[model samples]
Target: MLLSHDITILSPALALEDCEFPAIFNFGDSNSDTGGLAASLILPPPPYGETYFHMPAGRFSDGRLIIDFLAKSLGHPFLSAYLDSLGANFSHGANFATGSSTIRLPNRILPAPGGYSPFTLTIQYSQFLQLKNRSQLIRHRGGIFASLMPKEEYFSKALYTFDIGQNDLGEGFFDNQTLQEVNASVPDIMSKFSTNIKKIYDFGARSFWIHNTGPIGCLPYVLATYPSAQKDEVGCAKSYNEVAQHFNHKLRVAIVQLRKDLPLATFTYVDVYSVKYSLYKEPKRYGFELPLVACCGYGGKYNFNSSAECGGTVEVNGSQIFVGSCKRPSARVNWDGIHYTEAAAKFVFDKISTGAFSDPPFPLKQACHRNLD
Candidate 1:
């Protein structure tokens, strides 16, 4: 049985009624990536952003992600990728997320070889710092960075959000580590995460909204990777979900310690696992027809073919391969095996903004509204 605390203790007053922020600085993996990967690498092929953007926007989903929804709810325009140099506007803050990023160096305890990513959390922070320094230099030279948004205004007033850590665990499993070994690495994983937050906090960021890892076991990718001996009543791999639950528990404890360490910081740990698991438990409630299957791909029970990724084809034996996307992404929860559909992302954003699953129980609006210096 999954152990969880009652989140119903939240007060109605804490719900996101009316709140706003000048900007939001996001850091994470593809779950919240707007276009960072696109700006860096070849953008994801078609069907990647067909739901909302109506074109490939480098998001792993079929449309907008949680970060996009949160930005819209806060009245800020969609954030541009920090790495996208062409048309990025950092005035409303920048997205530093990449598609296959991990919170820590992959060599810590796991055998994963992902420590070489240019878009790791550390690299993202370096990019942010460079951007901040440039803004400062421009300010000193009497150049307006973004109309009224000087370097100080953007970092001081903007909300710092994160939806990372999935890859840290994902890569471990990818490297063929057992679930027990991956579960044991959670502490080291979160320590690096907390350290990264401290680096940003040192740069004058005080408001944070960190999302915990969701049900990795329930993801079609995980299901495909580890052919389960048996599935739970909801058709999810129980062992994998348990791993997520364990990671989330340790992460919550770390967040509490982080809160205690930074008295002035308003840190909110978003319970992504529970809220997302709810959608899986009752997909019909959220208007989802297939909660556990990918909306794209081919040659699998969940339409998630490893040989043929969401849109790209792999070369094998001098033959061309291809996989197609579903016509209706709106009815699906999972997108392309690993990522969530835009509809599922919106459902999560709506619930989390209401402050029900937030640690210390404060609506995002109130949390951001409080620490405006």
Candidate 2:
């Protein structure tokens, strides 16, 4: 485990030795997307990843995600998505997250009652497989593992991070599904995701940083969709957030169990819910102005209009519904109905950089320390 402070900054090659920055392989949903699905799939652009990148970077956010912040904080370069191969070097890391993904093995979302095929976790895993193959090529000089390492040392050193399952809750709750049904099904969904994590671990990933769900109840999309519900308490329709919390709790326990099962592996839990909530409580501390209202969207509470979505037009009451946007997005917390603004993400990065690593058996810094006692 090599701590960032242990690393001596010089050149990229020299930095690798000092930092020992493990190859960062991210697997999750749109929350951690760094431009894989958006580049491949056809969708309304211009709204996503627009804050800093000035264009859709495949991320559902208007800017970077937690993964991007983590990579930079760890002294690693920005991670490239598995789908993006243009001038991208897989020596460092790659992202395998897509929008609308779920943790269930064969997950599917009925966006509009069987209107379109939601991007499933299975598809994301397939993309991850593609990334793994590419990384192998880089390590073994064109897929010849024996050439790079002895038979005994074939496994590579990588840090695999997963941030998924919010979409599962979102689809169920927002699509008029029952909370009882979601609660009953969440554990099974987590089990399937855990299996994939275990598979990655078996494939030689020694370091794992898994994120818990965010405050789904606070999302502008949820708040605006259910105006009649009490804001102080969790919305009745969005009660699936509580179910998400249950899943996250189970995930934490599973991670603990996995650590016991694999003593050599280092696992860290990133409590994104707490982090985001802290920022929302005091946006000024993080240089943010509006934490509740989304920067991009048309009129309503939470700055959201159900008929209008990012990057595309919609018809509302026989009128052309155009989603409006803020002039200075840097002052806002949320970029869209579901994602954060670049400023918000930057603020999140600041929190994670500080003490987020201090929560357990393996703080992020401790996990990265090469000379772990």
Candidate 3:
């Protein structure tokens, strides 16, 4: 199996390797959400998915997300949301990501009008467990597979990707918690995350692609919400970024420990923070004009207003507020205050698939190969 020291020989061409894995089981929050939240709750209105999909596809961004690009790179069709019942197809895989989801269960109070959401990571896992059981039943009855694809092989060969945890920190800050207070909860947050991963691991999943939380301190919403905090050298929220860094460190360590425990398992930790930070630090280098501002939002610095949601306007004190979306979304990095544009998502996926950010440093395609002895 490829290891960290093998980076010297790895090439960008590695991304072109033949596609691997039978399917992909994805779990995350808005960052990787396709249409689960929209189908389960309310469909996000126009401008939310106008870029590529030309309609509200339930993605938090204007177009595709990093997970979409990842699926495309693997030569698989876009994974359908497990909750989307309208012509939903699980042939390729199922996406369980929902907007405003947290990894730790009890549900922290978010600044949003709803206070908190029931679609937490734990709920997603429960859905996955149910899917697995149903798949097993289908296999047993030879109803769909005709005894061809056993449930075990279906899960064992599928690639499992996680892009969660941002909401855990975001909700904490929204509730006026300090950096120290949020940092204190990192261990428990990661412990729950690790436990969920183990649940999947025990259920026949062998390949894992885990995306660490990104540099949340630089998000437009964070900057707009916490203006008093000192900015980093790169103009991001220094203290909040430190919290994200701390969490990422703990998460990486936990993944390494997981690898040690499951010797035959393939776990790839994708360093989304560094990749995203690089774009912010040097937006021009990545063809991005505005890296720290929202491409769509109401009037304010970075075009973001904390109270006003994207794509629609709300009446504030009998005044009609109009929130607008950028036409040139490809040139922008951020889509809304918290989500990223499809172009930015594609860029990150390109970088990640090159194997530079992955532990052991192998392209995603090659990383999916079974490491059986």
Candidate 4:
């Protein structure tokens, strides 16, 4: 309840503080997924966590994720996945994110470990709602695991973070929707996103740190998928990135509306697209190389092959081809075809945490205060 306005926080690429946020309740897709997908789905095999954990640590990157960096900055342990039961400690807060998640449930469903996760935003919220109530009971029950659960007050004081919606756009592409159709769907997608924010707001969330969708076209997957798609000056698909920009524009408008709707809450809409795009546009400026290619992918134009993903093996003429990481992951930007490398993730966190890319122009340390303009 009594949060000091102290502006002393640490960054992971710098771990990111004087503990600006007491706790962080994160929601979204793989961009911030700690381990929800791995717990319920296939575990990311070797080399996924080789750069940091030196083992399969349930992260998609070749090291830590942006969420991990954020936790380090706040001086709190990495948030345990709400779905992870093995050795999870949620005393600070919990992550409700998963890989291949969408704001709204997907229309197309494949049987048994489908293309996308069934743990949609709504489902994640339901899980959080359960935790919110159950933690109250657990704290009072006085069990041994009670210490691992979050305190009742942490819910109200924690930083609410979101880094989702990119997958929703990807789903549209997968469904064979035209670019215009995907562009038209942004409003409805954002509507669902806003509704979820309202639900979390009603549940006592006061400080929000939301990241806008990045340049979807910059990813090797998109580039490979739509070989005929238009390209930007930086060799990314221009139309796809435009759609992402459109989404970010609407997301900002939604934040403005949310600020008015929830008078007591502070909303920071972070512009992660610009920061991410810069990585591709100017990799050398940041000590990065091969910005457009995947560091842990197999052979292809972008070092990515969807059939033979990073850390995966495929048979070629009865011989197995092992997909591994590059020699120096720190020198690369993209991790897998779909995710950013830990180095890139760290670079992104350092820039965004400074509040240079946030709405209302407030740094992460000062994000709790409501912005008047």
Candidate 5:
């Protein structure tokens, strides 16, 4: 119930869980971003946070991102954005996610054709390193600042979650890179991702929950762009989804190797792509409608206009046009053509949290434990 600057703190979330994860340090893009992008650059306008926060809460969705739900489920308040200095409380942990983030830096750091962030995975890793060292320094001061910072022991006991790489594919696709060119970049992209994972593992992070990239081709933006491209039963671009599968395949392989290298770490590779794909494939079965359409967008067959995103004002010959949301967002899968709605996110979190889609077959509650086999 408490909406902090960078995150929404579940009012009764202070009673820590029996799972023993005192904090959660997340890294990734907008899927799990609390407010890192909003704090650094442009804030997501009204209706962005309407479903949950009822205001502009700095999230890209119409409500809670998966990270928000993950925090609440773990009996912790929402994570404060490491970039957000205003009214931030990092007692539990911090989020280093930003919209449009990629494992490799984009050719241009400028705002996307819409808006892309400058916080790449490397930059997020750098921020994480800074927080790990400086939080202790501030806590050593022993004041209100100390109260807001995470305890020294939380670093080793915290859950480390990642939900990036989607943007890496998006960036390549949008830049007019051929399908083969984007697919070819998977290995190097994953190498950097694995390198960052290893870097964090060296920093005493034991519990890692990494999400493979989702179906980028199913997104309305991509669908709109390649309208004539081949479509599956679900109407998603088959080739594009194949690229996502390629990315996930490389990512899983990297994770398996990482486990062999970092013996002490417990890495839970969550197959969120399948969960998300199923929703789009059978929207009605998942209590969703218009799986490919943007609930908050303007124009076209998918209710998405790339030039005019959700909750934005566009000019039409000197007159302003307010791009808004649909009345039934909870029933829609896509939020702003790029992100998932709160409802769809909840579905993803519910499925993945069960461990049914996870490697090592362990639920979120048992992510701290390593698999014997």
Candidate 6:
């Protein structure tokens, strides 16, 4: 049976009477990557989805990610991966998130370590522009927007959500880099990211959900790689998280300043770091355990293998190679080295539904509300 189009894209945001379910255009790293990476390349194996979909679905998690849950909670069905054309739907939204992607191109860190290329975001956006133009042509009798509207509403209301920067921190902190070098680059990184966001805004997206970096130091991969430091430790590469926070602060300020410059623009800052941190602090409440270890892997502590990944068999000695599996993934918070399980994603989405961060200074929901009319 064909699913309701509104069920896939319109319900969640429509539930919020004060907000409009603008076309959701997502851009970011693996944290929100629905399927762009795995579908493109082969890595990170089958057991990755053992507990959820019963098979791999290109997501980093055991099943879905925050983007999927958020889409559901917003009354939209799961978004179609930009790369997959089979059963793909663009009426609701499209996920442009690629694993290991960074806001800046030629990012000094992450990719070589395990992350995808920094240019992933730019590449996806270029694809988005092409798709959008094609869609316009097809729907407007080859006339584009000229035939679709009364000229004033030519540009449809759309929302752009960005969740990037974690890879940068992950690389700088763990991939043989000094804090001094990484910290020094924060200002420049933030500036470049801000510029990218502005570019998207110029592309006809007036509503935005701009996410900051999550608590990188608290990730299982980081925790296991550097176990001596506790979550509360001040100097333990908390510098990475600090950089993310600093960038978020600057982005918030910039968005506010930009509002004055462009009153019609609406920007919302999503504090993903805080939301994820809260879940880590109270895993049981979110139906998770071992928030620091991944459910899929061959390692001892973090459940990750830098040299190896989730799919396909490897040759050991002269013949047979063994694969890894999570005995109980539903109870685990993380799925692979860097992504969370769908259950964990649900917890984060629940917080967003509350509109707890709707106030000024960080106004995500407010931004959505403002553009409803």
TM-score to true structure, per model: 0.88, 0.81, 0.90, 0.93, 0.93, 0.80
Better of 4 and 6 by TM-score: 4
For model 2, residues 1-373, the per-residue Cα lDDT tens digits are: 3565455332222343322455677888777877666655644377666766777666777777778888887777788776665655555667777666677633344344422225555666665666556545555564633232122122255667788888777767765777787677777776777677777766677767778888787788887876765554322223535666787788788887787787777677777777777656777877777777888887776778766777667777987766656888888878887888777777766765554433353345445432233
Q: lDDT: which is higher, 5 or 6?
A: 5
lDDT of residue 309 for candidate 1: 86
- Reference-based TM-score, model 5: 0.93
Clashes of 2: 6
lDDT of 6 by residue, 1-373 (tens): 2456455344444344445564567888778877777666544467766666777777777777777766775567777777765666666667788787776665443334454454455676787676677666566664533332112232346557778877766667665777677777677677777676666666677777777677776665676677665346322236556666776676677767666766667766677778887766787877777777777655666766655555545566778455565777668767766677777777776776465543233233335554332
Worst 10 residues of 4 by lDDT: 7-16
Candidate 1 per-residue lDDT over residues 111-197, each given as its tens digit:
233342457898889988987888667666774444423356668777999988888888778778888999999988888888888
Clashing pairs in 5: 112-115, 112-116
Candidate order by decreasing TM-score? 4, 5, 3, 1, 2, 6
- Local accuracy of candidate 5 as per-residue lDDT tens digits, 130-203: 99899899989887798888888898999999999998888888889998999999999988998898888888
> lDDT tens digits, residues 230-309, model 4?
88899999999999999999999999999889999989899999999999899999999888888888877898888889
lDDT of each: 0.80, 0.67, 0.83, 0.88, 0.88, 0.65
List candidate 5 segments past 4 Å from native: 1-18, 112-115, 315-319
Better of 2 and 3 by TM-score: 3
Residue 157 accuracy (lDDT) in model 1: 70
lDDT (0-100) at residue 156 of candidate 1? Answer: 75
| Candidate 3 error regions (>4 Å) | 1-19, 106-114, 139-152, 315-321, 369-373
lDDT per residue as tens, model 3, 200-228: 88878889999999999899999998888
Q: How far is candidate 2 from the true structure (C-alpha RMSD, Å)?
A: 6.2
